[model samples]
Target: MKTFCGILWEGVRKELQMSFSAFFRLLLGALKSFLNAETLQCQVFTSDEENGQLESRFISLVSNDDHKFTCNKKILSSKSDVFKTLFAGSENDQCVRFQEIEKNLIKIDDVDGETLREILRYVYFDVVDQNIMDPNPNLPFKCLLAAEKYMLDQKFKDSCQDFLVLSVDDENAFDYFRLAENLNAEQLKLSVGDYISQYLTHKRDVLP
Candidate 1:
């Protein structure tokens, strides 16, 4: 009887120890991932020009101005699904984007250099200041596109959502609504609808 009790206790103790160890490991893994995602939360904004370019799995981007620059491939792939899929097929081979370049140089099409630089900065750092946005209202639209393309905005939660809603107005409210639909942002869609409804109602009341 004494021997059986001792063995039973030992087994229970071992099982509890294993469970605790596994739980601790899982907790650490989750914390690491959350920290990585939230690294730039509320940090002071910086531009690509001020901090210089980040170096991580570098890729070449040729802007519309015919200028060339290097960007961090890991950061781009992590932030943008478009980039990830672009590079996905070349797992066993060199990056497909680079191979397409005549001199083993890759270039992102359509987007200009300045715009790409701003997007990259947003990826590594955070949002550009309100001052930057004031002059170029379309800035947020581009950022929203990149965020949606990479499924990144989902990770940041309300930050992107609030920014989109705040930036909406009579001129761009519909644009935000369309973007919200594309991004599956149900909350923003509802918010955009509310804004449009109010605007139309106000306009109708003031008509001659």
Candidate 2:
């Protein structure tokens, strides 16, 4: 009976030891995973900080109305050939420096404050807000002109052209046709011609 009890006790002890050993191994693996995740997160954060520093370099612009705007230099240069040339000039000029708090001051004499603001919004966010344009029918035209002057992407000009095409009516068709001609927008000119032809046909049909 004593020998049997000793054997049973010894077996239980071994089982408990194995259980504890397995539990500790699992715990250690979990701890290692947690530490590795933390390290990866830290590395990502550091990389983001570095990129943020590069993106924060800015330049100052003054509109014809004297409204001032601060813009990201990299974004402006990357988006527009005109801005790229302007900033490239700054490299040779002593007046503009990336490290300077005053930044490179550019004067845009053709574009007014409000129009320039919209242009910058498109430059940064790639959007033209229609809510603002709806109340002022001339806003899209102004933005279109600015887009051309600044040498913005053709996609942006297309957005403005689309808005203008939608806003066309009997009252503004002639003016819009002239605008399309000046911009050399074949699509808009064609659309205006079609609208005018249909309108004149309908008017003739209803006449006494």
Q: Candidate 1, residues 70-148: lDDT per residue as tens digits?
A: 6556666777666776656545332333334653246655556655666666667755544436677566566656456
Cα-based lDDT at residue 59, candidate 1? 59
Predicted structure 2, TM vs. truth: 0.64
lDDT of 1 at 157: 32
Cα lDDT tens digits, model 2, 74-185, are 6787777777876676453432322233545667777888888888888877788877566787888898887776778887888888888888999999989998899887
Clashing pairs in 2: none
Error of 1 at 105 (Å): 2.5
TM-scores of the candidates in the order shown: 0.55, 0.64
Minimal lDDT window, size 10, model 2: 36-45
